[model samples]
Target: RKMSALAGRDNDYIFRQLLEYTSFTYTYILADPESKEAILIDPVIEMVNRDIKIIEDMGLNLKYAINTHVHADHVTGTGEIKKKIPSCKSMISKYSNAKADVQLSEGDKIKFGKFELEVRSTPGHTDGCLTYVWHQKNMAFTGDAILIRGCGRTDFQQGNSGRLYDSVHNQIFSLPPNFTLYPAHDYTGQTSTTVEEEKKLNPRLTKTKEEFIKIMKELNLPYPKQIDRAVPANMVCGMFELQDAKK
Candidate 1:
């Protein structure tokens, strides 16, 4: 089931659909209009044009193009977008083990006009995974660390069920009840949930740590179709060498 909601729209954080594959991947355009500043998160290479148009049409400056993690599904357009917007800086967690213009860590706040995004190191989906909290609007962007009504699968690279359990309960769930949660992927029919809602209703979250691990282990999930290719490319600093793609 596919889940979606028009959450960021009302907040003025304009979102444009770059790509939504059968695997259900998505690239987002999250912008702060007050500053005319913008960011592309988990962007798909295929949707590069649509992304560029939004920024060009709005006459906005793309200050950053960030990936929550080295994605293992679709090719990322982080490097591609940088060329179009020369002044735009590309950022990724320092743990990505890939080169980036701005390697960010926890406690680092990215300021945009009246907004400040506080970085929280939430490792579980990936060791270097980080989540952003925009204090100005009480919003949080959970890349694959946590999902809307569900949590990200921890069977992939650096994916540890124990780490995921701790990351959510200790770091994410601890946030105030009213903080809005915006996730990168929406696999279910729900879109954009509150942290409190996730802590209470997320199937994977509403259980004991021990039990959660049990469930994950039992699944014995299969590898993502592109994991072999995506992981290597992603760790290479999100570069799209022409020869390394699936035509």
Candidate 2:
């Protein structure tokens, strides 16, 4: 089923959080209210129709459909979204080796109207993982690099526990303590978390680098069931051909 929520809004931006229940993924929509130009982040293929409706109803000029990385748990909707909004380009990290209209790298900035998202290469969960920071908004869209209280399993897709340890500490934890972090997926029904909260309370991330690596190595997480199909489709920007497969 498709579910969405108006998480918050302010004079600076329009924010909404949409969820694909099956994967517990959260797709975010952020727009410059004044210009009505918007960007969709971490879009899921199954929810494209619902997401498009929201944009049209709000009269938003869809600017970009961006994937923080080449997702392995669910197919991305960037390709489908671009088809619906021809002017909307699809984007992914240049390091992802994925097909997209635009390839982003560290220090690259994505501008939609007056709002911008600064790209930070936070690789660990995957070699191409990215975290998009809206410095002005004091918020970041953290892919699978880190989660609400836990972190992504560094067991596949170029998984590296040591590298992940450094990425979070240097890239994410270094942000302002009050910066709100919106992760790609949340299973506990949590909406968002702040840098301060994660810094002090994140059981997996709060430990020292050595400790973090050790903990990650022992997680023994079950293999993701969708990876075989999800990765291929995501690589092509969600243009998957397996209609018989389920997300």
Candidate 3:
């Protein structure tokens, strides 16, 4: 699906989207219009063809495929995308224990043409989660750290409610109020929200840190169906072994 193209701070770059239906995941395409240098964020393995087609059609030079975290619901398309586009490098958090060409850390800057994204380590939903902020554009890609009305569950994958609370309040909420916040997943069909809106209106975030911890402790949410298959595959950068055809 085609989402709106958001111009950068100086209108020199564009942000495109490719939403995956099954996982409710949002893959972003950030590109510099002048140089046509582009990077993709959180790509889904199943949608590699569509993503490649889009990149090819736009005549953009794919530079990198970056993942916000090692997702439990869907396998990443980073490895496959790199195979298709040899020039594209795959990136992930240094703490994720996942294999990637580039392992990023906090304060690492990813540059594409004239635009740059600052990586902020925001571990909560997972210990490796990283939020990418486009400072000049006043925008952030919050990978499961702070959602629209809620946040990621602190029930698995090294999740810690207390850490999550601090990450949001200190790392994210501290940003300029008007900064646009784009999450990795939004099941309700809501596209985007602002940092101010999330700080003031997010039900989960409005509570005190202690209260938030209690709430997360009692969530008892069911495990994701794909966790068993996805986690292992994601660890190796989404390389899964298939059964023999003649079995």
The model with the greatest lDDT is 2
Query: Model 2: runs farther than 4 Å from truth?
Result: 1-9, 241-247
Candidate 1 TM-score, true structure as reference: 0.87
Counted clashes in each candidate structure: 2, 0, 0
lDDT, candidate 1, 158-181, per-residue tens: 888889889888878888889988
Please give the lDDT score for candidate 2.
0.88
- lDDT minimum window of 10 residues, candidate 2: 1-10
lDDT of 2 by residue, 25-132 (tens): 999998876678999999999999999999888778899999988888998998788778899999999989988899999999999888899999999988889999
lDDT of each: 0.74, 0.88, 0.88
How many angstroms is residue 129 displaced in model 2 relative to the true structure, after the best TM-score fit?
Answer: 0.5
Better of 1 and 2 by lDDT: 2
- Candidate 3: global Cα-lDDT? 0.88
Return model 3's CA RMSD, one decimal. Answer: 4.0
